[model samples]
Target: MDRLTNPIRPYAWGSTTAIPALLGVEPTGEPQAEMWMGAHPGAPSRVDRGAGEVPLSEVIAADPEGELGAAAVAKFGPALPFLFKILAAGAPLSLQVHPDLARAKEGFEDEERRGVPIDAGHRNYKDPNHKPELICALTHFDGLCGFRPPLEAADLLEGLGVDSLKPYVDLLRAHPVDAALREVLTAVLTADRAEMARTVADAAAAAERLGGPYAPYAGLVHHFPGDPGVIAAMLLNHVRLQPGEAMFLGAGVPHAYLDGLGVEIMANSDNVLRCGLTPKHVDVPELLEVVVFEPGEPAILRPEDEGEEVYETPIDEFRLSRYVLAPGAAPHSLPDTAPQILLCTAGRPRAGELTLAPGESVFVPAGETAVLSGAGTVFRATVVV
Candidate 1:
């Protein structure tokens, strides 16, 4: 096991103090958006060996079979299949969707063939793998995920009584859920800029007048005034998750984190096709192609208790589980087969010879066994071998 030092991404929408408070460090005053703990090439965590520090990526590259286990190396090649992150959102993130593996590979190869620079702002695919993620709330977390049922959205729009939204309402009421959602989203994304701005203003006003479920739309307008994403936000489900609660976002699902902090784990890829609510590139055609327009309730994941609370998902790339150790509790054995990233979120926990405080993490190599004890809450991220 090696203590890991990770970089914090300072995105504009990040909170100034949320990550600092969690790590028990003084605020840097700069926005700290995400603390990435993995061997992803973008920001690989540093592992402190006895003699010196080394990039985890380099370490894995030196001996893929020993570091990543033979099975993982054979299945996913010589790289970590999952990326773990501590995501803090003081403001909203971009409205985005991730492609499936097939689409991702096609987009990445196409862009490469077109001679687009890998670091270009307009480059959509950063990798050739799909990203399916799960975020477990560490604080009160709010987000927009997937699309709500068309009938429900229609009722909300009808209650707003905005003349501009009447067309959407009529479409929703007249068509089936999938067709209604597809058409409404298409219209919102492709609408004329001036006309969309007018519609947003009117919708914001209407949201203010009718203050029940429509209130969040007004808030969205405030955050991104005149942005077409404000109108797009009206189509998705608004989710608020308490601590310990989680949401799984699958491939082709559109989502954006609205506020608060969470422990997020996903496939190690960055192939995002954004639609709106960001200063970054927005490829409307690609986004439309990647997004799943089916309407339904967001799947709020609740961990299953079995000594540890397991947060299950469909993918085999990552498996996240949480352990809460009370004072005087017996030590628990860490998984001995797979490479794991153990993160201490609360209190001080001792694992083998290392002690971890809040926001501290360790990288446990495959074939290693360690016992965890003392009082704290720890989350374990490992591949599902």
Candidate 2:
């Protein structure tokens, strides 16, 4: 097996310290957040194929079906179709949605036919597949996912005592999900500046009065004062996952990665439609068109009690499972399937003879028998047939 070198993605929302600390490097004061370990074209991991730093794409091309397995090649075509990440969000990410597979394919092909550069900053769709993602929390991860039941939103809004927000609270109490969401979001996104500013000020005061851990929500109000997302956040379900917990996001789910480190796996697509809480492109009408507006709680995924420790999500592109190794525990054998990526989230562990520390990961190709011993917890990412 060739020792592969992973790629680090420098994104503005990334934590300056989290990933750098794991890599034993001094912080460059830049936000170095995601360390990608698979062969997704955006930031394909480098493989030392001989003496040069060749992209993993070249290595897989030499023997497409053999190296990546027939199942992967047939599904993804000539390259690794999944992207694996160690994502650390220092601040909240923009509320965004990904288009469905049909839309993604059409958009990508149309852009390509028009001769648009794939890496152009303005490029939205990069591949033909919809991006379905699963984030397994390595720390306490908080996020806004989907829409909250209208009654709960009404209760929160009513308690806040903001007169301008009362219309929205009442709308949620009375109207159906879509109409209520459309009306409320439309009002917030296109409200009169002075009226909305006063309402936000009152809401922040109210959130502070009814405070606990949620008191911090007011700080977010302070951080992006008058930003519509702060108000929009009230309308969505607030979910937090402890370490070892997981959440799945399919196409059209309005969600944001709030904070903390996580091992994330997603279908290789890179399309994103932003709603708010960012300085990046905001295609509000496009986002409004694609979002699933049913008012409900976020679905927290639990692993099925199979003989194997498996954390199953609601997608087909990738499946993430974790094995927490205790001191002196016997070596655990992993699921033998198509190509898999194994990562150590904590402690020191040995995969064959190579010792790995926290954040160190290795790619286990198909048909390989990988034995784990020594120490640390490991999360395995593989494709589900």
Candidate 3:
């Protein structure tokens, strides 16, 4: 097992302290967002084997199926087709949707056929796989997932009594799901600039008046001023998950990670169809095509206890288990059947003489059983199918 030095994503929405604290580094004042720990080619985790740092991709390629194991190879082909992340979202992410498997493959191939560069910022699809994701909250995570019933949203907006929002309230009350959403979204996005400014001002005041956690949402309104996403967000289900809780996002789900710390695991793809809430790239037609119009509450995943510190999720690409180990505890004997990555999240943990501090991780190849004797909380990542 080589000591892994993972890549950290520098996003504006990232937390300045959470990941920095984990790595024993003082906050850089800037957001140090996601610390990724997997062999996905986009930003592969690096292995420090005493000599120097090498991408985990190089390590995996040496053995391919052997490193990840036969099961992962059979399920996802000759690759560790998953990416794991310690995500910290201080600000909201773009409201976006991912394509289903078939659509993803087709979209990827089409982009490739057009000679689009993979690293291009405007490129929509990066891989030919669906990005079904599971986020286990490390802190209180607030987000908007799926969609709230239109009538419920209408009631909320009507109660707000912002005349500019009356159009949306009327649309929701009058039209069906697709037409109501499309019409309202179009009007919001393409509204008169001055009118939108006035509308947002009124809406923000109303949002604050409604009170509670959503009062802070008014502040976000100032950032994305007059942006349709602020209005669109009202139509989505507002969800908050406490620590150890999880939420799943399947393809075509119109969702946005609002804020907080979480561990996100997804299929090894970066295909995103963005609608709004950011200035990066918004492919409205494509987004509209892929996003599901269904309205419902977000699906919260409850991990089944397997009686061995194993937390089984409904995903096949990765299985994550949490181990809270105190000092003087016996060494953890991990399963030898598959490749596993052990990440220490709290305190210092020892594997023989090598001590893994918080944020430090170790990648154990398949068919190798290692013992972890530590004074910390460690999360084990391995392929399930």
Candidate 4:
């Protein structure tokens, strides 16, 4: 097991204090958004296995089969299939959706064939891999996920009683579930910028005045006033996750994290299609193609005991499980069939010989004999095999 030194992504939407508090460090005052803990090449974690401190990607690349095990390399290619993260949201992330595998490949290859630069702002697919994710809240987390039933959504908007929003409310009531959501979202995204800005402002004011169920929307406008996503966001279901609760965001699910801290794990891909609420490029046409238009409730996942308490998700790229250690509980053997990143989130737990404090993690190669002992909450990230 190698002690991992991860990179903290200082995105503007990050919380200044949440990640610092977890790591027992002083806030640098800059936003600390995500502490990435895997080999993604973009921000791969660092590890020192005697030779010198090097990026984990280089270490894995040198001996993919040895580090990741033969099965993982064969199954998910030479790269680590999962990217684990500690995501801290001080503000709302973009209203975004990710492409499914087929769409991802088509988009990536299409861009490459057209000679579009990979780093170009307009470029959508960062890689030809589907990014399905699970976020398990470490605090009282707030987010918007999927879509509500059309009439239900219309009721929420109608209650706000903003005149400019009446058209959307009428549209929502006029069409079938999927079409209502599709038309409202299309109108929100494709509307005249100045006109949409006015609507967003009105909606924001109404949300603020209403201030009950409408509070989260008011907060969105507080951060990004006049942004059309403030309106598009209302099309989705609002989810507030208490500690230890989880939500799985599958491909094409339109979602945004509004606030609080969470432990997130996803397939190692960064293909995102944005709807709104960002200064970043909004490929409306692409996003319309990528979003799943069906209305459904967000699935809130809780851990189930299957030797370890697992937060079950459908993707094979990653599996997340939690362990809450008491003072006298017997040590548990870690699953050794896959490469693992063991993160200690609270107290001091021992992973093999390395004792870990909150925010500390270790990279345990596949086939390693590892045991968990001591009193702390540890979240384990590994492949499904």
What is the lDDT of every predicted structure here?
0.89, 0.78, 0.80, 0.92
Could you tally the backbone clashes for each prediction? Answer: 0, 0, 0, 0
Write one digit per residue (lDDT tens) for candidate 3, span 205-306. 888878764564566576677666777777788888987778888888888887888888887888888766777777666777787888887877655553
In the range 1-385, model 4's lDDT, one tens digit per residue, is: 9999999999999999999999999999999999999998999999987888999999999999989999998899998999999999999999899899999999999999999999999899888999999999999999999998999899999898888889999999998877888889999888998998898888888889999989989978778878999999998899999999999999889999999999999999999898888888999888888888999989899876744789988878999999998887899998788899999999998998899999999999999978999999999999987
Best by lDDT: 4
Q: Return model 3's CA RMSD, one decimal.
A: 2.4
Query: Where in model 2 is the C-alpha error above 4 Å?
Result: 109-124, 192-198, 213-216, 304-308
Candidate 4: where is the Cα deviation over 4 Å? none
**Which wins on lDDT, candidate 3 or candidate 4?**
4
Error of 1 at 211 (Å): 3.2
TM-score of each: 0.97, 0.90, 0.91, 0.98
User: Candidate 4 at 233: error in angstroms?
Assistant: 0.5
User: Following a full C-alpha superposition, what root-mean-square deviation does model 1 have from the true structure?
Assistant: 1.3
**Residue 238 shift from truth in candidate 4, angstroms:** 0.7
Error of 1 at 351 (Å): 1.5
TM-score comparison, 1 vs 4, better candidate: 4
* Candidate scoring better on lDDT of 2 and 3: 3
The CA lDDT at 19 in model 2 is: 87
What's the true lDDT of residue 151 in model 3?
87
What tens-digit string does per-residue lDDT give for candidate 2 at 1-385?
4455888888888999988776677999999889998887667777775688887767777887777688777776777768889998888877778888888888889889998898886677777789988888888888888887878878888887788888888888788878888778767777776777778888888888889644646655665666677777787777888887888888888888788888888888778977666656665666776777787777787665532357777666787787777779888776556787778878888776767788788777777767788768877788876
Candidate No. with top TM-score: 4
Descending-TM-score candidate ranking = 4, 1, 3, 2
